[model samples]
Target: MTHKKLILHVSLATLSGLMIFAPVATIPAQASSVKPSSAMLKKSNSYYKKHYKAIAKKYKFTYSAQTGLNKSGTIYVYEKTKSSYLKKSLSLAMNYWNSKLGRQAIKVGSKKYHTVTFSVSNAKASKSDDSDAWWIPSTKKVQIRNSLYADDLSVITNTTLYNSEKSLVKTANANLAAYKAGLSTTDPDYQSKLDTYQQQQVDYAKAAFDNQESNLKSGLAIKAREFEYANTLAHEFGHVMGLKHSPNKSDLMYWASGTNDIYNYNKVKNSSKGFSLVTSTDVARAKLAVKVHNARN
Candidate 1:
């Protein structure tokens, strides 16, 4: 998810110059791995509070550290959409963060911590053309374009294709077995027939493997797009939790949307290998944000 800088010539003061906050410093990999001392954590919290408050004051926006999380440290989100599809996507996004952090960092509903609201609509022409979702800090709203919804048709198609492939594999194996069992070793051409059948089977097996591999890759791609949508929602939620864009493009907090990082499961950089939705740096920053908020209140 990327924030679109919108300039409005309206009388509504709060929405006049709506923009996202500036990028924060990227956490080093080693720093994220080592637990910080209380002194260091306090220093970091002071810096974050000063930085965020400065930005909000300069921009005439409200900055409330007391809003997004409860004292129990869970972020409760509410979705304001009637569509079950969008609701499920938000649920998946929240689950992604909670799993990565290994705790109940985000819950689906509770007005006590409803500092974040998720909603969906068609892409507005006023917003940037490339953005799939945007988050407004002052309003505590995350808006996702309806186009980002997963394709139900693709899922059905993949399932049908899988069943067809399974049936074909079973039939092929049975036919090959039947052909081999019916062969008569007493015939003069028995050896030639056996050799030919063996060769045909080898060829068929290789062809089938290749086809299945191709189909598997295609199916994985569809799944990846679905994951990307959920990842985008999670990315927006990251903003609500006080995370800024990362300099590392592989990170979930990166500024751009639709980089297709989920497709590369191998976690290789500069390749088709997939990476995790949230890096350790993102988790560390989110946890730190929670601590800062808790300390502030």
Candidate 2:
């Protein structure tokens, strides 16, 4: 008898896979001319030299002094995407950082001064699965996946639901001891009671997950998409400013697309206080990077 060959196929999907491309470029040698001097630059350099490691430890983002700024203390950004909406998004990101740093450290300019280039394309090219955008440190380029603009919101919805379920599972696991406190394995009905209790927990979790998913898919759907795009752009811009992934879930530079950040933005987008997508730590780090770059140049 001949046996047929067996085959198996597996598929995996993710919400967002924003990543920083490798091969970090070396910092060029500084010119022999007089080093630029300013009060903010001096303070930034002093603060960074003293507390960067502590800041990194606290904020969980890798530090680098790789600013794309020119000798005039401006990093020119060229928008090759040619989309007004994207331009606006880029402006928002630039303005947010400038406001935080109290300087025009970044600018929109011609290709000659364009150390940082922004573009949008539908082609996946070298991107990984579910990647929304990426930053190349070596070339200082950012490419946003155009497909995200027209996405159906299913990805964000599913990720939100999955996170909710995972949180519920964690809570259940933590309460397992309490769940078995009054039950004895020697009793004939113990297994049934335990199973019923577990099932009730599962049912409650399911209901909560369903409610969150529904809310995300309905009233918050559009805002969710908008937040994702804006956050992704800002996150890539963070990379441009020499910041790596942040471990804090609420930060825009968080490793993935930051569903928590997205949720927070949606909640406070219309608030009087407004939402700060970039955390204080992010601002501090970027300011240090700019100061270092300027000092060196």
Candidate 3:
């Protein structure tokens, strides 16, 4: 599969001044045919096989290493219980404007779609934080064919999203932007570099988010206050789908909260802030309006 050359974190200099996270240290590039971790490839391929081909040829596909969408998308949330931490967080994820990023998801156009499914976690046999999520192979195929790869994670789910450090989110977002830029028609070899860059970026982001969260953070639970906690989930979801901050301070996707209450876990904003979890850009990239395949492999 071909893809864009968007190896993960290079230098923040490529992006304008918006980056809030520092650049990761460099690593040598790898050859093609370097398979992704089994978990990442297995899930990503399913997402690609499910959605990428459905995208119309008329629309130019946009993607990089960490994140991208066809013309539209479907974000799938997988969890096992109705009240598990993951489930509660996903509830806010699907709420849109009620969600910081989900609200923005509507704006990115017909490129994406987000779907949530519940799978109960079996305690004793499995730990509560054992679950992870992804876009499925159909989405992966789009990235692979475009030469895209994941640097941080294939998909961000309940604990993974929030448990991550704030700085790591900044890094992934930049890598994602670089990946997206590679797909620009302006790039001379968009397809040629897409796969390697994508793979490296995605792999890099996953490791960074995971390691940083463990290294930099100590302890903190998602604050209660169903509505506010939901918004937080929504905000994090925006990061998951590759959204950046909005200039509008009132916007849920803003870099800082306009209300000075981002910490209010249950705060529900029926005000303009309430909307979907995935941002418009997130949807635009997913190529969601296309058809759906059977369950994930």
Candidate 4:
């Protein structure tokens, strides 16, 4: 299969009050037959063919020494489940990467989709972090939870909007502190000012809360099926490719959307043709990773 060069355009606002937009980069096509190590391919292909006839028939199984990641060497898609949205979501995610990289080694298998549940570690297990998907480094396998869906991402998006609104309220409260301190029982307009300020805070908080709910119901509902699901799927796969989390929020490798709230909202706003746009930083790192592997070998 032929693949076009990956190109990404990004805008950056500099400290000097100038917005700098990076030029689009066109990377040349790589050779088609960059095969993976035979030993790993033999084992992975055997596992797929023995258990998943559908997968064996559909995808080419190969390994890539350039990536130093055996997982991407062969793409194994679990059988389609009863949930059609989920099946489509997974397919879109897989296709997004494959088309961009020109890697068509995919296999559709009958193996049940994988899931990871968090069991209480001990008596003091009040806090638990459950993952929808994970990439196991040792085994080089990507495990996707059974509950993956488009609407599920609303939790994160809503939380971010909620926090941004809270930040606004906090700032308003800080501004009111001086006015509150100067108040006295003798003052005529003191009560009215206090009442107005309090009302303003209340109104601000309510507005923020309402926007959060509205965005979740409206914006996220539409985006989840289109770009968000594809973005999420690609993020998980980046981990499987041995990529560490990137500091840049726009990059697929960024793991902490909650802490960097504004970027989460911006991501939903700036999606490319039914999917999140992969940034130049992501492509550069991926190339560097492959280059590093080649240099070492």
Best by lDDT: 2
Lowest lDDT 10-residue stretch of candidate 4: 1-10
Model 1 score (lDDT): 0.56
lDDT of 2 by residue, 1-297 (tens): 000011111113333223433344321222221112344335655565666555444433344425455665566888887666667667766776778778887788777658778887686445424455767655667777766555535655654556567787888766666879878879999989888988888888778777776777674545555555555677777767656655555556555534454443235335322244777656766665555545445
Write candidate 1's Cα lDDT for 1-297 as tens digits. Answer: 254322222223232333333323223222122222444345665575666554333222222422555666677788788865456556777877988878988887755547577777676434325355767665666886565343332432343344445655676678777887898878899879877886776678568656644654565444444455566788877777766555555567765533423423322123231333677767766666666665555
For TM-score, candidate 1 versus 4, the one ahead is 1
Where does candidate 2 stray beyond 4 Å?
Answer: 1-67, 111-113, 125-130, 152-224, 257-274
lDDT of 4 by residue, 194-283 (tens): 999878877877886677567756755455444544555565555444345455555565543211322245455564445544555555
Runs with alpha carbons beyond 4 Å of true place in candidate 4: 1-131, 134-143, 148-154, 174-187, 218-229, 239-285, 288-297
Q: What lDDT score is found at residue 47 in candidate 1?
A: 73
Worst 10 residues of 1 by lDDT: 4-13
- Over 1-297, each residue of candidate 3 has an lDDT whose tens digit, in order, gives 111111112232131122222012111222222112333323444565655433322122222212322234334443434454444445555555334324333222222443333332222212221111222222331101111111212211222334344445577768867777758766787766776676776688788666534432332222222333344445434433433333333444444322323222123222324323343433443322122221212
| TM-scores for the candidates | 0.53, 0.54, 0.28, 0.41
Residue 234, candidate 2: C-alpha displacement in angstroms: 1.5
> Which model, 1 or 2, shows the larger TM-score?
2
